[model samples]
Target chain A: MKGPAISIQDLHVSYYGNEAVKGVSLSVETGNLVGIIGPNGAGKSTFLKAMLNLIPKDKGDVKVMGRTIKEVRKRIAYVPQRNDIDWDFPITVLDAVLIGTYPHLKLFRRPKKKDKEWAMQCLQRVGMQDFSKRQIGELSGGQQQRVFLARALAQQADLFFLDEPFVGVDVSSEETIVKILKELCRQGKTVIVVHHDLSKANDYFNQLILLNKELIGFGTVEEVFKPEVIKKAYKGQFAFMNEIGVSL
Target chain B: MAFIEAVMQYGFLQKALLTSVMVGIICGVIGCFIILRGMALMGDAISHAVLPGVAISYMLGINFFFGAVFSGVLTAIAIGFVSQNSRIKHDTSIGIMFTAAFASGIIIITMLKSSTDLYHILFGNVLAVRSSDMWITLGISLIVIAAVYLFYKELLVTSFDETMAAAYGLPVRFIHYFLMTLLTMVTVASLQTVGIVLVVAMLITPAAAAYLLTERLWVMIFLAAGIGVVSSIVGLYFSFTYNLASGATIVMAATSIFVLVFLFSPKHGLVWKTLRVKKKRASLV
Candidate 1:
């Protein structure tokens, strides 16, 4: 609890002998809303997955709350990209959210009434309480995203990793998710998001981590949002945001 | 009523009926996961791959069920290893491994020159199942059913989203192999009733029909088991009445039910969907 919430040192990942994340090292303090922004295939998602040990890493050292990721896995929650989920999976909104409690329950134990009540509370937090009984496939894009957020909320995790949470979501859902994320941060939780839209990056995240197969910048938005850092990461395509005076 | 009475008169018929029903429930329950995970072909492959195990077990004078189950699990792991190690897709690996295993079984059976009646193993003679075979089937069925019951949530979570299961520290790889082992046991247990050639039908058709009828997994499983039991009972009756191959008759019965559901189910059937479209167009006009 005294050190950074998440600390990674000299991380390297390879896919079929080609390095995706190359010697990346960064630390995120607790209670910060951080955005990892990069272009396509920039290892932004790979970094998060490697730190979580979701994917195999060639070389890395990652610690959460001064302990190994596996040691404190129960305190961490992850929301995969929308594409990673199968919409046709035969589960209700409430069941999907209740999966968050599986880490706490024993192997043969079912979700108790208390677990169901807590899941309902989490669903209410994301305004998905009304859709708890609906089939997952029947929900709209925003509703689905909110359901996933509610699942993460059910975990009551101190650290959260969301991959492209705003993709295909409605404007209102996007606003709602960001508001909830800020609220989580205010509650002393560390939230890391794999984001693509640089225009809204400054407004959405208090901290910025610019990456492109390597660490380009890691600091507060005011420090890491320099025009040079953006140009370096996006290969000069994003220089217009600065010239247009968009306050990025 | 007379037909039922006549069929129930023979002890062999009673044994076959019990075995068929037991196989039906086990295959139907496990098949829900099989079809839901899009592993219908894997079920087919594993079932076919068991033939060599049976042949080799007979040659070695051992329990053919153990041999068949072992071979089925080996085939599953081999398929996984090939797909994971090489560029070949999973289906292709299944195709390669199962075909080779099946061909080897055929060769082994042909070379043995024994009075083993390989035809019974291939096509199944459910009426010929002895009391020992019945007990083995019962034990396997109970284990499979119990495993499914105790680990239903883990199986659902893993089959639905493997990455999330691993993130939750659910030992995903172990669960996967365990499921494969259960599938093998189910396949072996079903061999006496449905035979190698038609076992996959028992593993897929009823479950798929159930999937078409329900929006919930538990409902799908129960529906699948119901469909499987009905198919077994009806198919057994037809086989008795017409003096037909029991395994083929059972498969046809299950397929007929699937066809009916595919065309006429109220929610997802093609006919209802087309009718709804036409009604909407008429209203617009």
Candidate 2:
């Protein structure tokens, strides 16, 4: 971990007159795989949205790679937590993967051969190359998550914000995503994941940003994920966290 | 010999037949997108909303098609803008826009000093379909079909998961607005042949029947077109024999087909699934 890749200062997020994320601030280093662990309704998702400026913040500043988020939009990729899409829609998986290249492609210019090849490569990375021509509805939950990851891969950005990528996914898919994240960090790309499982924290991420609406702590897994901070962040919750201490 | 003589007798009947087949093809291709995207109600709303556009165009004494296109797309854009800005959902926005458009059409019709040409807007007197309207519908439908074929993949992704598509750098916002505009155009063009009330049946029923039959997109589109042509031809024959409105009869026929398919489709049909379950239980016993 070196200089900060993402800087957050006094961030606050509210929804429909209720504050979900109170004042929070943290800086994340470049190429660090960060895990956010908190109890349910602890504003984890809200904080993630605020980081990307996807949701309106009451008062805050988020700078990615020393520039404002809007200025560095192309360098950042976001995969939403809950996507309420119409599943039976008429499109092949290849079409869905191709969309990941939209931000880089010129407006009004159709996708060229190189763009198609990139889409295929991303799907291949996710091991979904065989399902490229399959209908989206035919895919299982884990397969769908892989496609989502493939979309992010297509972006080829420096920073990726993923909201709960492992939820409802199969073991193989989870391992595949973890491997991909590791590869991403190796390539000097930062990956921020909103993870629910505390047991897998140490195994998945080197840096831990513990929170419960407020920033409890942010450091390496060894430094920040102590018993004291874990209790404060997820007190009276996570029976599994008590049974197994950060090793699943 | 008698049937051949009847076919050769009147040019109007031949024109009407050709018009129905062309419109059938257009509806079949477009309606597949509508069904898959769950915009079946959007198509319905646009058909009803085109009424005022037609009535106002008729009063202006200009190309009615142009008037319909302008008004229909305007209503669509308005709906899109309002829904995006407001907290209201897409369905609610559609309902509000559809009612307002319909009311405006009624007011305009009542204000016109001339006698109510209600049939032109409501039932679409196929007997009165001019060569001019035919040319317009044909040209616009061809363009729309061609566009759909070209951007087949983009339309699918946006329809399935808009946010993911947007994040991936797809112009989801543009596609959303473009889809509504195209739908409005299709509705306006078909208004003369099918009327505001029956155009929905033309847009929805064929695709719905196709949905019951297949999960494949290409197959659904083909099936929808086949059903549309059958309904149009059979209904036209019935209308000619019984002195009924051709458009109304065609929609009724399509509705009947929908009911039949919905009841008896092998996989997802109501009757087959029920009976199959019962048979499985019986075998277990």
Candidate 3:
């Protein structure tokens, strides 16, 4: 709510000598739901990963909450693409959510009873408390996504980063996740999502980061959703966005 | 009863029993992570790759433990290096490197035709296990147990999702190498009981069977260790009584348990799934 919660200066990322994300500079204020949208190969995931320090960045200075990622890592919570992990792993839902408390606990220390109650509360927020004992593999895609949200909520961080969280999610689950993210924002948290659904970008987030290897626009949804900006970022590949009947 | 009597009658059989059970428990503990991380083949690779190390150690009149662990861990790191740095898939690298080390081991073993104990190193002869080997197995078992106990959270995160672990500032690569090191130590510790060749079965089968039967990792670990203990106990019985090859017998016992769980596990078994479908159909009709 004070300075920018996330600030990046000329960030760059590439894969194996090929440039994936180019010089992108932006500062996002806290307590807002922001969406990063682009085409399939627009490096949306790459940009988010680079910022989160999940992947190697060729060049950049990325800071969260006025500190380097390593210095303020405990305040950052990340939920990677659901499919990026093994769903069939033999882990119960509650146990998965308990992983969020790991960062707060000291090394070699187990999650205390209070942590369990807090995790349960996080699960309840996403309406997943009933399925706490269920194995994660048995859940529907939407339910799985909600559990991920619950885990993020349990992190109790000032910022959240989720990548393609709604890819296979059901409509109700999508609504639930957006509602929770908004609640986090209401609580003065910054939520950044790498979303591909151009249709729901306006509804789900207050700010939009249109990216395609470079920063095309970064501002309020109304201010940045211009036709030219969308076209420029999508490289004339805004056919689907047009079909959605946006003013852009 | 005869096997139990033999175990009571002979110190050698007692040592074999203790050593095999230790191998079983440690293998089961480590194998959960191995299989869960989808590195079951890495288990096999490290096991086989220890062959050359064992051969060199024997030739040099040293304990095979250090040499075997060195070769096994080195081969594991090399596989990761090749797969990571090049276009070669992990499995291909594993197949290439482990087999090369194993072949080198075979040649070295062949040249040392005077040593009758080397074949035991390959196929495992628990009866011939020495007191030093038992102590080493005990030590490795304690270390593996304590390590898993201490680092349960980190292991859970890394095994489930590496990116999330890295995001939390965990050293993902360090965890991988640490696991490979533990695996190499385990593979080496198991040499006298299951040996270099058949140790992978002990590592995989019990853990996999437990995975099918449980929904929690801690539960799976416990179940796996239990099954591993049972397999070794049963295996030693049959081997001691029938005069069969100990490693093969132990591996077969573990496999039989895995097959049973695959077909008849109460929760995730194929048979239960089919029966549930049939019951639903009958009710609908």
Candidate 4:
């Protein structure tokens, strides 16, 4: 609560003796729409998971809201990639969102009417109120992503981590998601996204953390979105674009 | 009607019938989760692993139920440990542990030359179920059903998305082990009636049919139970009248129902989907 909203120091993660996320350090302030852009297999998703303590970190110091991750885990929400979910699972959209409140409920107690109402409200926020009763498999890819966002919203978390939220999503759903994310930032919540598209990165995030297995730059869009930094992070593969003034 | 009357005249027949119904309901309930999680092979492994436990229990002159449950749980843990600690995949782990345990059981039986019939344990003799076995089946069924009812949501979430469950701070590991323990208990309770060879069918076929019929978890569960009970009753009647192997007859009954649902269920059945496709093509023409 005093320092940055999220602080990572000397974070290192490995899988099968191969380093996935090299030693990295960064700090993010509260209310920042931070985009973590990197090449494929550059540990963008691994870094987010490491920060949340979802995966084992070989060496790292991660603190959220000036507190250790364990102390504030309940205050954090994560929307994993769509590929990690079972699309054919037999659950309604409302039931899926209501799972977010499971941390607050007592054991052996079912979700009450008020909890259902709150879940409906979260669905409404994501423009999925009409589809709450439908099974998850019946929805299109974009609607499914929106439903996942609604689940995150139902958590009422102050810190949100989304991995590839726009992949395979329709344009309208992507816009709706961006609008809701900006809204969350306006409400003083920190939203960190693992983004891929470089063209819309400037318009989407106020702060950008360019990474390629290591921290390349962490600053505002104007400060960090430079030609030299983009070229270095993408290993000189970024083509020069006159519109964004950077070649990512 | 006369055949039913003649079958019901014996006390052993009455006990066996009750045991069949109880086994049917319990297996049906647990089978829904098994098939949903794609753990049908795991169910097969645990059931097979119980053979050694039964042999050992007979050697020690203890309750075979305890031995069978212990062996089943030990197999589950071994599978989990092997898969987690090594590069061996889950299916491979299951295959290794179950075959080894089953082999050990056979060896022990042969070495001891125990008079306890191994054939009965392997293929089951449902008509031979004693009153005590019926009581044990009843108690285990009650416990399994209650556990499923109490932790339905937690189990549902964990089975659906384990990561989300862990993120929500639910004791996912504990839930997993507890579910494994319940699976073992059910497997052990069912051993006397269905035997090792056919137990997996009892745990899978009815639930699979129900899965084809319904889209909701609770509905699938209830429908599975209904299918299991009906199959058990009909199979028992046929076994009584025709003097066939009761366990095999019951499994065949469940399989018949599954085939019917697979072909004819209005929502997800193969026939309907094919018909719908043909109709659309015809309309285009």
Superposed by TM-score, candidate 2 places the C-alpha of residue B68 at a distance from the truth, in angstroms, of 2.8
Reported per model, the fraction of native interface contacts reproduced equals: 0.57, 0.35, 0.85, 0.39
The positional error of residue A65 in candidate 1, measured at the CA in angstroms, is 1.2
- A1-248: candidate 4 lDDT, tens digit per residue: 43599999999998888898888998999999999998888899999888888788999899889889888878888888898898877678999999888767777899999999999999999999999888898999899999999989988999999999999999999999999999999999999999986878999999998888888888999988887788788774555344456533
Q: Looking at model 2, give its docking quality level.
A: acceptable
lDDT of 1 by residue, B205-240 (tens): 999999889888999999999899999998888888
Mark the 10 consecutive residues where model 2 chain B has the least summed lDDT.
B160-169
**lDDT tens per residue, model 4, B68-150:** 98998888999999998889999999999999999999998888786457888887888899888999999999999999999
Q: Name the runs in model 4 displaced over 4 angstroms.
A: A236-248
For residue A194, model 1's alpha carbon misses the true position, in angstroms, by 0.9
Positional deviation of A53 in candidate 2, in angstroms? 5.1
- Chain A TM-score of candidate 4 vs. true chain A: 0.94
Better of 1 and 3 by lDDT: 3
Tens digits of per-residue lDDT, candidate 3, B62-85, equal: 988889889988898889889888
What's model 4's lDDT at B285? 100
Error of 2 at A101 (Å): 5.5
**Model 3 alpha-carbon drift over 4 Å, by segment:** A239-248
Q: Write the per-residue lDDT of candidate 3 for residues A127-159, one digit (tens) a residue.
A: 999999999989999999999888888888889
Q: What is the lDDT of residue A45 in candidate 2?
A: 84
Instruction: TM-score each candidate.
Output: 0.96, 0.83, 0.97, 0.95
- TM-score of predicted chain B versus true chain B for each candidate: 0.97, 0.93, 0.97, 0.97
Better of 1 and 2 by TM-score: 1
Pairs with steric clashes in candidate 2: A103-B169
